[model samples]
Target: MTPPNTGRRSEASRRAVLTAALDLLQEVEYAKISIEGLASRAGVGKQTIYRWWPSKGAVIFDAFLMLSEGAEGGPVQLPDTGDLAADLTEVLRATVTELNEPRYEQPMRALATEIAHDPELAAIYAERLDGPLREAKRQRLRRAQRAGQLAEDLDLDVAVDLIWGPLFQRWLHRSGPLTTEYADRLVATALDGLRPRR
Candidate 1:
């Protein structure tokens, strides 16, 4: 049985490990990060890292979670100004900007690469990272539903996916630049289909 103080120290060490992982990911590609290197950068023993995480991918997952602060793009709450188009436009535009930020880009790429290779990590990433953002968007859609701004038959879950899909695709594939104008167009297209006609 570990002492109560042991839990605190463990949490602190975990935080340090995550911080170091993020730093390393920024400095070097994901393929090069190692548990031993993470331990050194975190100022923790290698044994400590092994005691918690099984692989560097797991460390990257935790690091992404920490960097996202349990939410995507900053705050978790979606704006509900009663104007669904405007609110979604603002949110997606901000997401575009956040995805492009240098500090966030590396971890985002690392997480994506990790998920591609590891199914378990993919699940964890969805639970910790994608789920919260999806839920927030769902809640906002529900608000629009309540306001009768959106069609009663509008599938909230799919709608959320639809709104986010293009943004994620662009960011993940680097197919094109994400911009406020792109977000605005996406909002217009999505809302035109979902919103109640005048």
Candidate 2:
């Protein structure tokens, strides 16, 4: 059986460890990070970090997850202006800006690289981070459906992917510029395909 948790102090240590992981990731390549480094930077014992996280990849993934959830330190929620296209565009444009920001971009790239190589870490990321974010996207899409902006028959999962996939791909591959104009076009194109037919 697992031991009982240490409540607030443990939570504080976890936050410190995560913050240290992000700071180290930004300063050095992912491959260079180690448990010793993280523990030292966080001012926690190596055992403490190991007790909570299984590996350096998990630590880095969690750090990225926290920042992605909210760069300004608040919960991230999609806007429900009752305008589906506009809402998506606004979110995507904000994503573009965040992706361009050095603080978010570098750590994100590290986490992405780690996820690609570590299947277990990837599964954790999908469950903890991607799942909630996708659900939120679906919720916004559902609102659009209710508002008569999207077709009732549309698959919310596929719709979420269809809308977010391009921006992600572009960012991952550096395929093209992620400008607001591009975001607008993506929303317009996706909405055109998703809207109810006459």
Candidate 3:
């Protein structure tokens, strides 16, 4: 029923739409962005965008995902040097740098703002972005726990929340500079309680 060229055109249009959506997000806050603008910037008909995504929020999320490569640009696996403090400190420091990068900041903020007002977008984002990141962190923490580097009684998920929550709060709220020093402090405070002690 569909021509072979149809699939190629659809893919091309989708990419253009996503690229335009990301560009617009950088220039305008999420609340102010519109489908008409996205279509014009993308050079596609409004119908093309609506066919692929239900909302601008969905387009923005997909764009972020594509840019980050699904958050795989960072360390693929947690550093397990058998030293919990060092490993966590290194990871958090890298995370701070990643969050502070201008390329990631605006779009991330846009997505966060969109999620707050839209439950459906929040659910999709959780499944695509949040869930993967949480799972990776949990797996890393579990490794530390099994190595006796972390306390046997420590809850990995809660521990991850404790360590990462402050960083997220700072980035999302613009509360403070997300520096290596700040990340180190977070890791230190969280590890002080988590690390196995004599």
Candidate 4:
């Protein structure tokens, strides 16, 4: 399914559909959600949804993205108060909170599952969500490098993964708690290698 042309889309209807999707997701498991349910909840025709979104996963993903963007209306950004360790700690702690939030956990897991199996949807996820975020993380790392806080020759891409990969793995596998303390440890341990040599 082709991505919707924003030029022709109605903002009001789009918001309704996204809101309905989130509401419906809260009411039932992801596997149980249907386009019909979304249409009815949103008070729009099924064709309206089909016109804009390629699949159920796409709609749900957009809903989560919208929620993340928030009422302030901006792309989410990682904290960059010039303290690399503190900024990473703050971001990771928030990640733990979001991953553990009951409202978000199921829908996020559902999206993750869809991205894993559907190459097209996965591409969209990476393009719309993951890419910007990784860039922001790298931007922060670059700042640290320039300030002589981080290894000058460090690979930002791998550094981003080193900090985030474990937390995600733990959450995805249910291998351990995603507590603030765990987030702190992840940042500290990753920074041990990232910090500039003595």
Clashes of each: 0, 0, 0, 0
For model 4, the superposed segments whose C-alpha errors exceed 4 Å read: 1-9, 71-77, 193-198
Stretches of candidate 2 exceeding 4 Å from the true structure: 1-12, 68-76, 194-198
lDDT of each: 0.86, 0.85, 0.84, 0.86
lDDT of 2 by residue, 102-141 (tens): 8888788888888889998888888877776788888888
Write the candidate numbers in order of decreasing TM-score: 3, 1, 4, 2
Winner on TM-score (1 vs 3): 3
| TM-score attained by model 3 | 0.89
Global local distance difference test of model 4: 0.86
In Å, residue 6's CA in model 4 sits off its true spot by: 14
Which 10-residue span in candidate 3 carries the lowest summed lDDT? 70-79
**TM-score per candidate, chains pooled:** 0.86, 0.81, 0.89, 0.84
lDDT value for model 3? 0.84
* Residue-by-residue lDDT tens digits, candidate 1, 33-145: 88889999999999999989888888888787788665545657888888888888888888899999999999988888889899998888788777887888899899889
Best of the candidates, TM-score = 3
Clashing residue pairs, candidate 3?
none
Residues 100-188 of candidate 4: C-alpha lDDT, one tens digit per residue: 99888877887888888889999998898888888888888888899999988899899988999999899999999779999998888
